[model samples]
Target: MHFLQQVINGIAQGCIYGLIAIGFVLIYKATETVSFVQGELMMLGAFLGLVLITVLGIPYWLAVPATLLAMMAFGFLVERVAISPILGEPAFSIVMLTLGIGYVARGAVMMIPELGTELQVLPVPYRDQSVAIGGLIIGMERLVVPAVTAALCLMLYLMFRFTRIGVAMQAASQSQSAAYYMGIPVRRLNGLVWGMAAGVAAIAGLLLAPIVMIDSNMGFIGLKAFPAAVVGGMASLPGAVVGGVTIGVIESLAGYLLPEGFKDVAAYVVVLIMLMVRPNGLFGGEVRKKV
Candidate 1:
């Protein structure tokens, strides 16, 4: 029963990591660029939700959608102003610029008069709610996270499977020149992709805020989730979620079963093992050598 409890807790936490990794996968698929600011985006989203709910007194339901839209627009703006000009530049340069942007965002958040370096609670309705079933108990937010993530994944899958815009994004990611020549607005779609990814990150933030609360350093969780992205395969969306859950389960089991401090580094250890064993990742498409 205790082990089952850990698994449930891990799944809930893993859902958060998986959601962030999905953002990573989305952007990478669209632009072939890795944005390290994803964690900060999640943090920023949580802050936005907190302000909406607590500061502005908005209802939690409305605040969530509002935060998601705002974050999406912010992401679109970021791609246009900061990343668009250097579209063809080296990946390293773009990565550095994103890192700078993330730091600037964090600093800006800290500068807000009502929000400083202090940890703040997001006044979510489910803050203290819990559910028990068959001798296992967990918070409502924990259960909600997985359900929301699963829904979002299904929605995205459907979008890609049936939507024209989705097909165009796929085409663009595969070969930008070909997509452009096919009359697809590659630039515009890429911006939208970033926006969508940011929107996804915002959902993650909203779901996670009640569980972990909001803090300046919370964005650093992105580092742990990064391994989830890599372990699942940077280019595969489903892989990201699977990798995240795997890491989460491992961490939970380690924390309970292993010596002190193993929990903190367990995710990275799994990532290392995955890299050594299956660099392509589970569910990732096979790499082909060019003639």
Candidate 2:
């Protein structure tokens, strides 16, 4: 029972990691460039939610969509201003640019008066609430986290499966040159993808702020989530969630069963093992070699 309880806790934590991992997968799919600042984006989203709900006195319900939209626009700006100009540059340059963007975001957040650099709690209705299912107990945030993540994933799957825009995004991801030649607005879609990634990061932030207090350093969780992306195969969307849960479960089990410090390193250890064993990940598509 205790072990089961820990698994539940880990799943909740993994859900958060997976949500951020989705941002990694989305941006990579759209532009073939890895954004190292996803964690900072998530952190910024949380701060936006906190400000909207607490500082401005907006209701949580309204703040949710407002914050999401705002983040989406901010994401679009990031792509246009920072990422778009260097579309053909080497991947390393883009990666470093993103890292710099993240640092700027963190610094900008710290510049906010009274809110920056201060620890703050989000006003969630379900905070401290719990339910008892048989002999096991569960916190509301823990239950909600996985549930929300699952729903979001389902929505994304459907979007990519049935929507015309989804098909265009897929085409662009597969081959931007071909997609553009086919009359698709590949560059515009790239901006939209960045926006989409940012919006998703914001949603993750909103879901997570209730579970953990908002802080500038909380973005460090993105470092842990990056492993989830690698473990799941950077190109596979569904794999991100799977990798996150796997990492979460491993971390939880390690913390309980292994030495005190093993928990922090457990996720990376799994990543190393997975990379050594199956670089493609559990659900990752095979990379076809060109002649």
Top model by TM-score, which number?
Answer: 2
State the displacement of the C-alpha of residue 190, model 1, in Å, after optimal TM-score superposition: 0.7
lDDT of 2 by residue, 1-291 (tens): 999998998999998899899999999989889998889999999999999998899998999999999999999999999899998899999999999999999999989877888888999888899999999989998899999999999999999989999999998888777898999998899899899889888988988888888988788889989999999999888999999999988899899889899999999999999999998887787886354
RMSD of each: 1.2, 1.1
Candidate 1: clashing pairs of residues: none
Candidate 2 Cα outliers beyond 4 Å, as residue runs: 289-291
- What lDDT score belongs to each candidate, Candidate 1 first? 0.89, 0.91
lDDT of 2 at 154: 98
Candidate 1 residues 31-72, lDDT tens each? 778899899999999999989988899999999999999999
User: How displaced is residue 203 in candidate 2, in Å?
Assistant: 1.1
**lDDT score, candidate 2, position 261:** 99
Hey, what RMSD does candidate 1 come out at?
Answer: 1.2
